[model samples]
Target: RLRAGVVMLIDLLSSVPSVVFGLWGILVVAPAITGVYTNISSALSGVPVLRTVFSGAPISGRSFFTAGLILAIMITPIITSITRETFATVPRAQKDAAYALGATNWEMIRGSVLPFSRSGIVAGVLLGFGRAIGETIAVALVIGSSPQITQRLFSSGDALSAVIANQFGESTGTYQAALIGMGVLLFVITLVISAFARAMIARAERRIGAESV
Candidate 1:
């Protein structure tokens, strides 16, 4: 419930310009962290700090966390809207039935209601995942734009969408083909995940129907 409400708020917030968020991340949040990191180093050193504060601020252009976070910002609104719609679709009669059976709100949501709407929720989530995977400009602006992969949230890395966004214009024939190939790979992955989610949803629906009958 907490997460849903937060996602709802973020979704509402995200309807604003993504560039605004990107720029805000760049100008404000980045500086604060850079200052903190630099200050920690300066404090540890006994000698007076020669390097200017944040003069060599980390580029912070790309990292897995940065890309994921930017994409999350872009997709929050979409996911929240989809979730709201899915929840709305739950039949009033079914909810009332659960209530009559002495089910609490959480119980009703956990049992009768969720099972019926599970497929739609899964569908919505898969769509949101796809949207996150495809976001470009917002991610490009903040992602350190690095090609190498690293596990650290602070390290820079690029996603397929970010790479395409960064290099497509300058790309020549073979480079463009390579970019297209990356797109194809992403498309394939998305398609597979969607198909799997749909299949699982279908199986769950069938199981629920059987159990109910």
Candidate 2:
């Protein structure tokens, strides 16, 4: 009952509108991280290679780091849910065999459960990555939509989805095609990632089946 309740709560939270997260990011999280972003940016400026990546005019609340943080929060429950489901599907006999072999609980999880679930976990992670990359409004709201490429996480930058979402209404002719092109690129990237993840899962399943036989 408690577990079910917890799952229900997570589902509710996960289903929240992206716009709400955007607003929350702007009003709450962005401001909260400003000090940390400033400190990190300042610290990294001293190192040569790190300076290139972290160097920018100034740290702003709205940046790639803020958008990424929000995306991570948004996708975490999805990955967690998928991983939990995968773990639940592990064979009872495998667990029993581990116990019979005098494996401790932690050892059984590490040796038996994790090995079995690794592919599923990877798939879940890839799915979460897809979700993060495709997110438009929430990321757009927080990411400070500058079109320039910069290595600094604290500097303003634009993602493909953000560009489409923010500019689609005003964009015309070649600009519209350009935005569509970006969408196509994003779609291709996601498709490739998903396909790779699926292939990994299938390979893992086949290996496990062969071992069992």
Candidate 3:
């Protein structure tokens, strides 16, 4: 239920200018994390605290996770809508049959709704992922524009979108060509991933149909 809400919100929010969310994420979530603790070194005392709890504590802003979370918020609605619509198409008879067999709600969902709607869910998720991958202005602002990957969720890192968005304006000649090439690469990668997801979903549907028969 919470996830669904996030999805719906994200879909609506994402349609908003990427700049808006980017600014909002940077201003809101980033500062929220920053205010929680001074730094990881201070938070992680010399003592051997439980790895999970210590790791879970907040730190700085502009981290990779923050960027991903912000991106998720932007894309959730698209995924949720697609997933909801997909699930809606599942035959009522299938759900009724499961319920008649004394299946719990979870069981009905898992066995009937999930299997039947797997393709749609996969497609939705893949589309969301693509949106995240290509997101530019919003991610640029929240992601701190750092080029390197970091272990900290709050530590900044650059994404392809950020790099492109940042550099494209100043680039010329070969540099421009290179930037465009990067975009081409991104396009190809997304297309390949989308294709793979579609194929996988198709295969899953076929397998489920065969098993049901």
The TM-score leader among the candidates is 2
For lDDT, the strongest prediction is 2
Better of 1 and 2 by TM-score: 2
lDDT of each: 0.68, 0.86, 0.76
lDDT digits (tens) for residues 1-213 of candidate 1: 997788668767767776777776666655556556456445645544433321233555334545566667676676666566667766687889999999999999998777777776777678778767766666777777878755445555667887987898899999999999998888898888778766755765575557556
lDDT of 3 by residue, 1-213 (tens): 997776666567646887888888888888786655345535665547433233433344766767877888888777878778777767788999999999999999999999788877888899778777888888888777777655555566788878998999999999899989999998888888778767866766676567567
What global local distance difference test value does model 2 have? 0.86
Compute the lDDT of residue 164 as modeled in candidate 2.
Answer: 92
Pairs in steric clash, model 1: 61-143, 61-144, 62-143, 62-144, 62-156, 62-157
Q: Decide which is better by TM-score, 2 or 3.
A: 2
TM-score, structure 3 vs. true: 0.76
Mind giving the per-residue lDDT tens digits that candidate 2 earns over 1-213? Answer: 998998898788788999999999988988888888777768887898887775563345899888999999899888888788778878889999999999999999999999999988998899889888889999999999998988787788999999998899999999999999999999999888878877876776786678667
RMSD of each: 7.1, 2.6, 4.6
TM per prediction: 0.68, 0.87, 0.76
**Residue ranges of candidate 1 with Cα displaced over 4 Å:** 1-14, 32-62, 188-213
Report how far residue 169 has shifted in candidate 2, in Å: 1.2
For residue 186, model 3's alpha carbon misses the true position, in angstroms, by 0.9
Model 1 gets an lDDT of 0.68
